[model samples]
Target: MNANGPVTAPPTTGPPEHPARAEIDAEENLLEKRRRLVLRRLKQFLGMAVAGTLLLLLNDLLLVHSSAAPSLVVTLGVFFTALCLSYQGRARASLILLITGVLATVGVVLWLEQGIRDSAAVMAMTFPVVVSAMAGSRPLFFTTTALAALVLMAVALGDITGLHPHHVRPVRLSALISLEVVMLAVGASIALIARDLRHALHDAYQQAASAREARRQMEALAFLDPLTGLPNRAAMAQHFEREAARASRDQRRLGVFFLDLDNFKTVNDSLGHPAGDALLRQVAEALLSVVRKGDVVSRIGGDEFMVLVPDLQSDLDVPALADKLVKRLTQPFHVDGASVTATCSLGIALYPDDGHDFAELVKRADTAMYHAKNAGRNALRLFNEDMNSNVVEHLHLLNGMRQALEHGRFELHYQPQINIRNGDIVGCEALLRWREPGLGLIPPSRFIPAAEKSGLIVEIGTWVLQEACRQIKRWDDAGLPGITVAVNLSSVQFKRGDIEQVILNALDSARLTANRLELELTESLLIEDSERFSGLLKRLNELGLTFSIDDFGTGYSNLGYLNRFDVDRLKIDRSFVHDICTDTHHQTIVRAVVQIAGSLGMAVIAEGVEDQATADKLLELGCELGQGWLWSPALAADDYAAYVRQQGRAAPA
Candidate 1:
């Protein structure tokens, strides 16, 4: 393994919350608290008023002469009116009425009775202060307390100055002064306690607000992707649950689309990770723009996104929506001043039809996504029952491959690459084949793709390279003519495996010279990171090892890389050679490849030549090298050695 350090995702901060909304919520809470307090106080005042009215009526009936009857009647009227106002939801009006009525009644009773010496005077002075405190108004509390103190002092001064001559008992100055001191002391103490309680209440509200904000932020971080600022997988699951309930209730359909970008790794490798991150952000924004307002787009992880579309009227709507998404994403994005183009493979699974649960639907959709990628990217596929069987088979194949590798069930077969003019074996391509105990002679097509997808190709490719080198040395030691052995390299091995080190170690262990080994690479690999690959290819070339582009015309056919890299040979794909004698297009393609190879000082080899006519046509096109069934099919190591020996005796020296 290459064993490079892990790449960490960049850090992102949570979005800022709206301050105005928080302030509004806090204000509403305070108002609700004050309303409840006022209502409770009003009920208490109403109860006391009913009891006092009955007592006053009894007193009026018992007394021979009573001067307080009018004041008592007025107090009863004011209390009833305040009750009616409070019941009508006019809390402020009711509180104002109660305060005014209390002050007027207390002033009249003080004048009519024993002035400051009356016990009613003390109740009158403190009632407004208590009510103001309950109302949670600091200014009103202090103002009411000041007015109560002034009334007490005024009454004391009046009694001392003999302003009221109708007193039943003469009041003493020491007693009046003591009463004034006691009332002031009590009022000041109430004010201090109310002030402390208000401060504590304000602090408590602030702390609660802070706690709420913190919890909100934590929820955001838990459910959001930091890089794309979209909903993450956890959020998608929660959203699915909610949407599933709604869809079930309404008898509607829900669509789950699994989307993955194609060739995203090339961007990360060539342009750097920052550009890749920028491209992902642009992709997220574009998906958001194309989806409906109610639809959800979530970033599952790294270049893979899942979209949830609910309230679908019909299953037919999915294809149209998928096309729209594909068209939007396929457009070029400008990242880091480079115009980059990307395509997506989308897989769709519908609720109630594909599966009822989220996990099952996602799995099916993911399977479909791989199908779309396999067919060719920038396309969409719908989940089917047949795909499920394929998934099960794939799992079995992966397990079997692992067991096969561990138990040495894998072996290489060498196919001779023939010289067209001389009819002699020059080199052979090593092809891997698996022969399980139950399933004998498993083809490369069956397991190679699985291995590549599962990342087992790197280990498998390592084994192939080592074995080919050792086999070549054995052939040399056996006194056979020295012929090079070519091994195909998977892109996975080139990128993730320490290929150079593995090759060097294999050569050293086998005692094989570098020139006897040939590496066959795909065209896509050469153009991925040309600069880095150029340096690596140059180093490998300096060691006398050679490279050939395998299946050349099937992939990226840019001629620039032919000159840029240290490529020695071009292997024309079998598709062109299969019908070369009959198809004019195939002949033209082969002829062009031959000319290009000759111009670049490279060799051309046509694969899949089946008969004499095809081989003769290839020779006319100036391609002197060939390999196919016309020569010999791929054989085991021992069979290949015998075949080479037989061909050697047949060749004219």
Candidate 2:
């Protein structure tokens, strides 16, 4: 399987070179080397054969004038047959046949002439040994050498015993000994040289193999994710370039899907890093399973993956792929005997439509992915121009917020929480408001998300806590009625910021009671790590601080945590309260919350109550406290102070 593509099949080979192809190439190279060796030896043999045949013909017809024609013709026939065998690729057989024929011809000449005393016949015996050595076969070279020695010994014995009818000259012992010594030296020298050549060839092949392996490993390290074995960002970029070029040439669409696992950090924190790694690997598998064969799936670091879908027939094909990914990823993954369910937010960008380059496409896809996350995770969003505008605005807002935090342009507004039955201002929820120099008052909805995303919310939340405490002290100094001041806590502040320390510092510096400062936390934040948060809540509760679930019923309203943490209040979110007077669904939710809160000995406060009828309905539903336009919108510090004083004077004791 290719790392650049889907990993549904087990990897049989890596990139750049497949094992089977490399093996075939190596086999072909070896065969070519053998072919060259055989051809070179055959050429040498052919030259020697031609020269020997001509010399024999000349000695028989022009010089010696003996009838050696039959012997010469037999030699020619043997040479032709060897040449035919070599051409048919039977190199070893041809070599053996050629050596045998040369030995037979030389032995016959020695017997017919002076036997052991024939100088030319003894010299001719060296041909078979030399040819075998040239063939690079150690066994064949040694065998031919031994055969030549036996042939010499036989010729000497036959001559000495008068077994050769044609032997007329007596063999000289010194001449025979000198010839045997020369043949032995030549054969040994040739054998040693052949052995050295083989060793050098072996070493060269080994070095080449090592270099190839090193290059393959380097490529794997550069392109593949260590954990998931998927193509990483660098490989993805290369794949994108190739796919993009093809799409442009073919006039086809290419979709880039950027995937981010929702609440992945929570998974790491809850399941530990090992389990998180396992989860990521499983996610990679699921992604590969969803994509087509040619599509590319890459792990772009830290729970983020990119899928490049090429050769898209039409835009209609994109959503089906995206939906498949979302559905497949949202399913439960079993890791270390634990069933962990993960949902991914996917953002898609099309080639030549959303972006023209890899980086631009990825950026746009990332922006769209964040939009999917913001639209509530486990969804897919296609890249659009408006998302880019929103992204630009978000960047501007993020930058502005950073500046505002540094320049002290951020402030809090107090919205009065009224008692539904007595019309008394029971408490006021602190709302964060930003006043930029030229932009006027920037609403929380527009900038709060940007702040949260940029991690400025932690510092900003600290400021809100400190400022709310100071204002509460200022109101007490002004001799106003003592009421709880509720400040909203961001999940980021709770997780990353030292909330307990910041709260303690604020209350201590302002000399305000902790109970008078209520921390409004969302249900999702509380349920994230309940056991850890339970301990923190317990510690804060011991410090005489009050805790309320803000924007209740808008999240996973798990009552198990409410009882576990012992929360003091549940602030009903404005959505249900806005239509509680008429919408039966909203009314039912309110009633359920009121009943649940009442059973748990917790106070329920309704937010976004705008009229007397809504307030009356909340009161009728057993909710006594309400905060909305019914009493007053969130006001400035001075306005809230004046409003409190007026409410105190107007109320009958």
Candidate 3:
């Protein structure tokens, strides 16, 4: 089909994009059709009601009029009026009009029956008045006029032949003229009022219609997310519940895709939140282009979207649509005058295969999405039950891990950072390890994301900090060495301003010096509330605590703000270290950071060292220290302490 305007997207397939409209024209069309239908019904009802009332009154009025011809005219007028009211598309008020027509016909017949004797009577004046003014309805009024003329001919013919002019004299034409003036004035006034009432009724119906439309719009807005214009979690749940029942009844296939934007936070941090929101809106529009009718899309997370597609008979179509969505979203997004490409990771789950219920399917989809990100993003993953063994087992491990923390089931393992030249143990970074009753060693990374999401990090982080402080204090008490302990903080914990108090509580609890503890933070932490964070950093510095920038190369780095915040060290991310010796660009960046740190009177440490050449190159390049698998792949707390003692014994201090 031909599209209006040059179509920016491929026109042949998928859903249409809605440019935010003042009115949803498609829904408006449905409402307009319904409204007109309702008006037609109302008019038909109005015609019937008025016509019924007039028919009932006809026989009673005709009995007084006496003349069979006049009574016959009255009865016929009422019957026709009732028939017209019963016809389709007649309004109730139109029935009132039918009544008016019956009245006019009756009046004309009465005048004819009374002859010239009663011409001066109200009924005679009324007959002519009604005949002249009932012209609004051409067919009925004309028929009444023609019949009235016949009745007038019969009456005039009878009067000319009457032998005795008992009830009448030579007809007074002047009196008839006076009666005509009064009747015309009365009829015009009644017609004017009726016309005014019709206009008022039309206005009322229009206002009622406008109110109904506004109500629907308000309801729509309530169920939709303002940012994305997609259904929210509440709306999605409602829709899913309804669709699930329908699908179950029909035995159709249902699919849910949980989509998460990859590296979205990095974009938000680097470009500012305004740009991030624009990116989200653009992504919403992009997703809209991939959903068909009978499908729903919802925003369930800050950067996550849920899509529900139903009424499929087979799984073949589900994958194809999911593939289409991934392709469409993985394409570039132009936002805020910048052409930035963003990739969405899709986790697909089908009914009965992935889950038997709505929430279960969504959960499985989420699990698949988590794996998608870990397996490298910009891809789609179908949820598999066999994979759930690993995930379900992993969740069990995580839950056990949390319980262990609650009952002190975890312990700290520290690795020392040695002074290579002097062979002295300076400080150790504290790592967490879980020894389950059945399973073996579990790493921090295996459960940390879950910890952060579950708000368990606060508890785990506190334990690590306090335990590391106690270890430092124990080493000092044994007269082994003066060394510092570095503790990693999660983003959630760091945002807690009372983290200083937590540190102090640990210090006081362990009876350790503040100078011997160093706090480590990554580049991602720098994105929110920089000024407030800088204040916290300075405050901690004043309390005799030191700060280090951890995993520096992985985030948006502003070298301009180093000395301003009194940072003591920069830890290079391991990604750059993997190719530093071979890649000139990588080496240049490392060298520049090393020199910049040196200039700022701060130390630099490169993490993830695996070979001697890289270590030699870093020392040659004026790097302060190195840590990673090349030296050791993390050791137990006791092993680290012994290594520190043995190395300190060999140093020529």
Candidate 4:
């Protein structure tokens, strides 16, 4: 019920009509037409009955001078009275009375009237045949015509025998016979016309029924998946809106379950698309069977199904229901005479919890389903706040990083590398940094993950290389001693076949020598695709460019690559150097790295050498290069240039 009394259904727009409903509608229309026809005929009969009764009473009391007047009068009055009575309830009964009245009037006129030839009585007796035709009944028309024929025969016998005063000579009898023949022809015509009318009505009814059924089929095809007979994604979206509204009104939880079939591609690959389609249909049926009455299971697209549970008693109910579905869907199904088993990964999101709207809920549920697949197939997971937070933050970072690239929000800091023997300045490593306007100085750690995840690292890393080379050229032109500037390369950038082109463009644009610019890479980058990495390194090395493995001892320390490739130096990871003076493990690893560098004809640079003791230990261990807070932390470009000039003045030229 709505705010009004009983709720009324909205009028149907068109098609997809239920077969039973269509039949009921057609029957109701037929019944209504019949009711109206019956009522019309009954009124017409009542008018004829009233008028005939008055005309009979007047003729018997004044006009007619016959011995049968009273009998005819009584019969007409009785017949009229019966018609009026039957008209109150039964229309068919009133029609019967009218037919009987015509027969009775003809019989009375012929038997009682004397010497009545060419009288109006014969014409009046034909009224029943006309009335029967008007009533659209072939049975009544034929019955009245037969009865009238018998009456004519009786009148002809009466005239010949003089049993009544009415008699006809042969010449007048011929005219009367002609009149009977014309009336019979007219009755036959009316019967034939009525039969044709009935056939036309039936044909029209059948056509209307067929058209309605075709419309219903078209509507079903639009919203339903033809193969599986399940509501499609479009229909599911509509269902979600309606169910969400209802859940909001009742303050109930609505659970959206996103299900994806596992190993379905294997079926398509091995058996054929026909078998895969059959498997999808079986899965749809299984899901439909397990859901409650109010729940809707829809085939979203290809091997994926969405179930919307509109009302739940508690949030806890979602897991048990999901488990039941997973168990049921995992059972073996027969397709193309072969038994196959498939599993589903399900992710659930609740109304007013995971999301308040349809799209959000679907996305979250899809994400959770992906997590379930990652965890292992044939499992279920519910969306949690942690997932939402992480996804939202990642999205924010990706957007911000794009904006930062276009607007010149990035900065580069250079850390000076020094010689452990003479404390002489050699070269500095350029590091990329970002300082968002409002957020202020976002470290590389904060934004690098976003860049890497979005594949923006390639573009950003290219910019870093170009800027680092350009800075090195500016410092060299400023009367500072020529120093090699090392720029770190992201694994994504290093793997591209165009890396050498990007490097040459940067060096040419900055007007710097290849040896003065070194490319730094991590051990993992080399280990990922070593053959490709080695070929790329060889090509760049042939161009007079230098290469170093950055943050060594932290990743796969494959020493064989150092011997196979033309590498110059190793920047020891800060993890070992930060505690080198105190941790014995750090001392031992540093000694091993220095020995390996000697064996491979490479120089070793100790990074994060923060104290005099760590520096002294590196020099004693035959590692001649180092950089840390002990010398100076990484500084802005201009500040590093000032530090470089000061260091040059301090050195013994």
Candidate lDDT values, in order: 0.79, 0.80, 0.67, 0.76
Q: Roughly what TM-score does model 2 have, to 2 decimal places?
A: 0.53
lDDT of 4 by residue, 408-513 (tens): 8888999888898888887888988888988888888877865664456887888898888888888778877476788988887866427888999999999877
Model 2 regions more than 4 Å off: 1-201, 213-387, 477-483, 509-511, 649-653
lDDT for each residue of candidate 3 in 381-410, tens digit (9 for 90 to 100): 778846335434434444465468768778
Instruction: Report the lDDT of model 2 for residue 384.
Output: 80
Quote each prediction's TM-score. Answer: 0.54, 0.53, 0.52, 0.46
Q: Least lDDT summed over 10 consecutive residues: which range in candidate 1?
A: 1-10
Q: Pick the candidate with the highest lDDT.
A: 2
Candidate 2, 245-296: lDDT as tens digits: 9899999878889999997898899889988988898898888877777888
- The clash tally of candidate 1 reads 0
In candidate 3, which residue ranges exceed 4 Å CA deviation?
1-154, 159-177, 188-238, 241-384, 387-401, 449-459, 473-481, 495-501, 508-513, 527-529, 574-590, 609-616, 628-633, 645-653
Off by over 4 Å in 4: 1-353, 356-387, 649-653
Model 2 clash tally? 0
Better of 1 and 3 by TM-score: 1
